[model samples]
Target: MEINELTEPERRVWEAFPRGAAVDLTGAPEREIRARVLRSLLLTAPTEDGEIAGLRLLGARVTGELDLQYGLIPCAVTLWDCDFERTPRLYGAEFRQLNLSKSRLPALWAATLRVDGVLRLTDCRIPGPVALAGARIAGALFMDRAVLGTESDGSQEWRDRAGRALQLDHATIGDDLWGPHLTVFGKARLDGATVTGVVQLDSARFHHPSDTALDAETLAVGTDLHAMRMRVEGRLNLRGATIPGQLNLAFARLANPGGVALRASGCTAGEFWMREAAPVEGALNLRRARFDLLHIAPEVWPGEVRTDGLTYTALAPVLPAADRLALPLRDPDGYVPYAYEQLTASYRRIGDDAAARTVQLAKQRRHRTTLPLYGRLWGHLQDVTVGYGFRPMRAAGWLLGLLLLGALVYGLHHPRPLKADEAPAFNALAYSLDLLLPIVDFGQERAYTPAGAYQWLSYLLIAAGWILATTFVAGVNRAVNRP
Candidate 1:
């Protein structure tokens, strides 16, 4: 289109843009460039040496829908220090690059927008929702130091409410999603989003108390999800998500009292880091989650941590076996079988049989605390007799004690012989052995019987022998079949 043929607004934008480099339109009159005029100038700009330069609008007040539903932007579009009267509705817009850093917009409805280069919205103040559902970015999505959501009114209700703040659902980013030190007063939804690189929210603050502050459900991050030192007032959901790299929650403070503060159910990560994290006020749901290694400390582990179906291959090398079991044993819910299983399996994976046995024995003892009176008594009996299937030698020790007691009693009694052929000193030790071992008789038990209390000793020996022998056999069987 010729310069004379262009409309007034189009001519202004066309004449204002310098060829081959970035132009400063800050000194120009504050004109509200309509969408059609802006589109016309961007599509058919002046040629310079047989090449058209990209349009960079700086410090311009843009109005109307900057919609590009039917065409592709041939060059980059940069906006800086611009104020939009309405939400930039660029639904299905395709461009080489987009940078709206330091701009003020009510909202962004860029659903399915395709950007070949970087989409930088860094340091912008967006008080309304920033939706990018189904958009594809070939480069990084940088929103670092951005201030989102309304200002706090000091009302608890207002602080707790999580109005829609940021949405990236189903959006695909070729590079990282780096937003450090960013403050969001409401929820930041990344549900079903895919990032080829890390999703770093280090030192960020999310202040939504009544609802979820960060929801990244089913998100697939190729690298780590680093949220170290982040302070979240509500739950952070990553249920069914998969992170090929670590999910580092170290030094993070996530608080949602009486509700789940973090839910990573069915999520799989390469490694999990929770070392030195602040005490979570609510439950940490890790049900069915899997990780190769877990880096956590007992002091920072919350009071209520669900471990059902949660499995880890190894514990951090710095963590001792005792410290690992200490957390689950301190759970107020008492013995959680899966909690024990998680520890045992982790130790077993590292071929540490001794540690696995220790965890199993601790699990049995903890379980006994929650049982009825009779059940507890049975557990104690098993403990003294067989050491809960971990120590079969204890049963052998009891058997030896009983055998010696029977021998001393029989010798002191000096029973008279029933058979005339048997002598008075006819091997009293043999007689004791006969009574102590129920399976064998040696003809001494029936040949002579002790009178009074000595007779009671024979029956006691017989019952003790049966109980000890049965317990020893059962314990050995359990130890053999446990692995």
Candidate 2:
């Protein structure tokens, strides 16, 4: 169509735009679309081509219902110098990338935008606020110096990457945002964006060392918030961003939250500065990263982040509360689970089996209350090394007390002799009673009744107790006594 064939609003927009401002659209075209877009362009860019331009469409507007299925849209070839009074409902609009590098984008509102190519917004301006609450945009949405701020919309002010989301991982955002300097590089930056739409980042990278990445130090907003169950395919950087909402980095991973379940794995921001961040309802993640002094839970750095399987330096302090109780520790020389695991494993390999057993016992007793689940006979002795691990004198004292108590009880209540031996002192019948009495008492009681064969039974019980106690002592020596 000729330039004169354009609608009133279309004509105005083309005039306001630089000399080459063009809108090659198809299907039923509407004038309202042209007028709104033109106004927005003027606000962000007082002049698109370093010259005056106007908006007046003589033709119809390119309007159509959203179609996520085929991603059909009559407004395919979008032009410059346009102001979106409303988001111009394009429900499930899908298309190749829209290059608005030299144009203007004011109040660029949309619920979802799926572009197969790059949604480049190089150097542009926005009049009012740009709301993409539940907008799902495929490909990268590049916004280099393309302001995402709110104009004089009253006292209620807002930010840039608020709303449902805008998947621009690895995309560049070159401004400090309207209010908060957030990196518009995720599926959502709505930490406190007012809109209650659920933001998702199944696996999005957050870095643009090229275009918009260098202008600002702070990048991405989800650094202090959880992607819920979204997949994070890239690094989440929140070097300096105000998080008005709680940060939830748990259960999400840069690799996968399912296979291994990373509490806070994907994020590797050395010093996660969430001082301006809000308290999370559940937990924050810092899993699978090498942090010098992390602030998240100890789980973030379970034990120590070993690099290349080398002896790694402990970054964070072992949570006393976490390590206070002994756990069923795994082997020491094998793979280490956490820092505490090493303690237990050391006991297991403490040179001698007897000593190892003693250490294991100590660990179990010490962490009994604190580590109920990990309280294993063997494991406990390994990690904790309880009660100084059985001193001979201490053992003697306890044994003496037990013997005295037993003697007193025996002298007081001796069972009537089942039979008396005629032989001097050597009661053959009493010898028979010796074994039978234990069977009768223990067998009939249906409980763990101690044997009545005082001399013999006592000797056996003492032997068993000593063995267990000895194992603990050995384990303690191996664990603490070692460097």
Every model: Cα RMSD to truth: 3.8, 15.2
RMSD of 1: 3.8
lDDT of 2 by residue, 333-401 (tens): 323334333333433443433444354444445445454454554544433323344443444344444
Which pairs clash inside model 1?
none
Give each model's whole-structure lDDT: 0.80, 0.36
Clashes of each: 0, 62
Model 1 TM-score (2 dp): 0.85
Best by TM-score: 1
Indicate the residue-level lDDT of 1 in model 2: 28
Leading candidate by lDDT: 1
| C-alpha-based local distance difference test score of model 1 | 0.80
